[model samples]
Target: MEKILVVSSNKTASETLLDFLRGSFKCTPKIVESAYQAKVHLNSDVLTELVMINSPLMDESGVEFAEYVTENTTANCILLIKAETAEKISERAEKAGVIIVGKPFSKAILYQIVRTVDIAVSRSVELYLRNARLEEKINEIQTIDKAKFMLMEYKSMTESEAHAYIEQYAMNKRKKKSIAALAIIDKLSEQYL
Candidate 1:
């Protein structure tokens, strides 16, 4: 199940919010009374999809916590603040990509914000995975290129010959071309070095 962390110093208010989240959202709600506790929850192995903070946590301001959450984690955050304070920090919240909900929020407002943030978190995760795959592909290509050069210079094989050699080795070993290339590079390095 998806997890959500709620930071609020007020016991009664936190309980109310927790109950509402449990009833309305399809997620596990974890409550923390201070920013420090929130950090502990965030650092745990479980991935949190959404974080909601009520302004003025026991040890730190909610805005600061929101900033930290946004910069350090992929989770999306919504900070509840007094209307006056919300106006003051609107720009900072926008820059940090945190959603700010002014105080005196109805349950409907909170639900909508959570829904929006959940969608954003999902998209961010997808993008992160896509980029990671692309990076791995780029690294594989570079390693293969370096191994090809090693074969050309050390084995006196032409470019096409070196390419074919690696491909054949990979097919015979049932390994990826990059893995075969890395093995060749390691063997050459061991012999020469």
Candidate 2:
């Protein structure tokens, strides 16, 4: 259900680009004859998730369109350019926070590139979340350790006995201590929900 955009004046180029991308991505492209028409699509297609602009468009330059897209859309914008312009296009895309897929395109290459980008984005987001959780876990460990130490120090209970009591309390209540610990952490943390 992912939406894609293709701005190409040449029917052959549009078809070829679609042929390569469709084989790999679950993509529905808004094809247009010129970059100007692409601008219209960009404004209206709120659901679009990606853009592929082929250079040499009838109405506008691919680089120019890519700039506009970066300014206007949250979608991942990529360029389709000839080998000679590959470096140039990529430099611009990089500055615009987009990526470029070089022309003489192949289905395999497109598939690999798209898959890699998806994985990288997902992994980065995951790591950010995991790191935030790790901070919470560290605080939880400090609290639980204090609790365990209190039983040994104040009640004069052996370390093993204190551990057993906590385990039994946790089991009898049908609740994991880790879950309780996380609840404590959540209460302390300023979460939105």
Candidate 3:
């Protein structure tokens, strides 16, 4: 479970937000009353995955804190402000680039937000892992390609002859091209040893 820090001055408001998030977001929240505490929470090497702030605090407004957090911290930031007809809360959320959860948050909306964030995080992790695998595969292919070219250029072997030699002598015995490709990379890694 990710740790989501809630930095808010309004005790009742913070409790309300926490009640909504704890069950749905399944996040361990650290609530603070001022931006200074929020800063301290951020600066400390705690494993907070997200940081939230209330709309109004004596030290600073939520928007200011959100902006500061977005600019300074790696953790995702959000401003939780009561929904008003004036559009002030929305304007601040947009300008800060931090997410906003409507005031008097409903259970449905809370779950929806948590689920949306979950999907986004899942997709990001998937893409990162996929890219890593692709890089490894490319490196393996390059190593095999280099070996093939070396055989052709340095040993004056035909393409078919080189392929046949590797087929006969490779660790996988040419059962799979991927096996041979990876073997080439393994052989190259030995040189750095």
Candidate 4:
């Protein structure tokens, strides 16, 4: 279930929103009265998926909390503000990459915002995972190249010959080329060190 942190001081509003979120999204939402309390939840390794910051957080505007969340965490945020403050709130929200939910919003609108957040979060995660895989591939290629260079220099083998040697070893041992390359690099390291 998605975990949501709600920063709001109004007990009635918080409770009402929590019920809506729970019923509509099956979200696990927790309420805090201040941005500081929200920070406490963030620092506690809660892995909150979304943060909903109600404008006029005890002593500060929700924009401050939203900005903090944007800078400090990967969680998506929805900043709720009064229509009168929409202009200011929207500027801050734009800078912080937060979604805006104007106060007195309809249930349908809130649900739509939550759905958009879910889609954005999923896309962010997918992009992150793809980048991680690409990085791993780059590292493997670098390691294999280093191993090939070592073989070429020490054993007087051509580049293709060194690559073929590693491939053959990997095939025979039922290992990946990256694994075989690491073993070769380890052996070379002992001699060079």
Highest-scoring model, lDDT? 1
TM-score of each: 0.87, 0.58, 0.67, 0.89
Clashes of 4: 0
Clashes of each: 0, 0, 0, 0
Q: Name the TM-score of candidate 3.
A: 0.67
Clashing residue pairs, candidate 2?
none
Question: Could you tell me which residue pairs clash in candidate 3?
Answer: none
lDDT of 1 by residue, 98-167 (tens): 8999998899988887877777777888999999999999999999999999999999999999999999
TM-score, ranked from best to worst: 4, 1, 3, 2
Question: Can you write out model 3's per-residue Cα lDDT over 55-136, one digit (the tens) per residue?
Answer: 7787866677888887787667766676772156676566666788767777787677667766776676689899999998
Where does candidate 2 stray beyond 4 Å?
Answer: 119-193
Write one digit per residue (lDDT tens) for candidate 4, span 1-193: 3878888888888898899888988777888999888999999955788999887888687787888898899788888899778766677678778888777799899888888888878888799999999999999999899999999988789999999999998898899999999999899888875
Better of 1 and 3 by lDDT: 1
- How far out, in Å, is residue 32 in model 2? 1.3
Clashing pairs in 4: none
Pairwise TM-score winner, candidates 1 and 4 = 4
- The Cα RMSD of model 2 versus the native structure comes to 6.9
Q: Residue-wise lDDT of candidate 2 within 98-178, one digit each (tens)?
A: 778777877778777777766765676689799999998887667666556666666677878766766776677677765
lDDT of each: 0.89, 0.72, 0.71, 0.87
Candidate 1 contains a number of clashing pairs equal to: 0
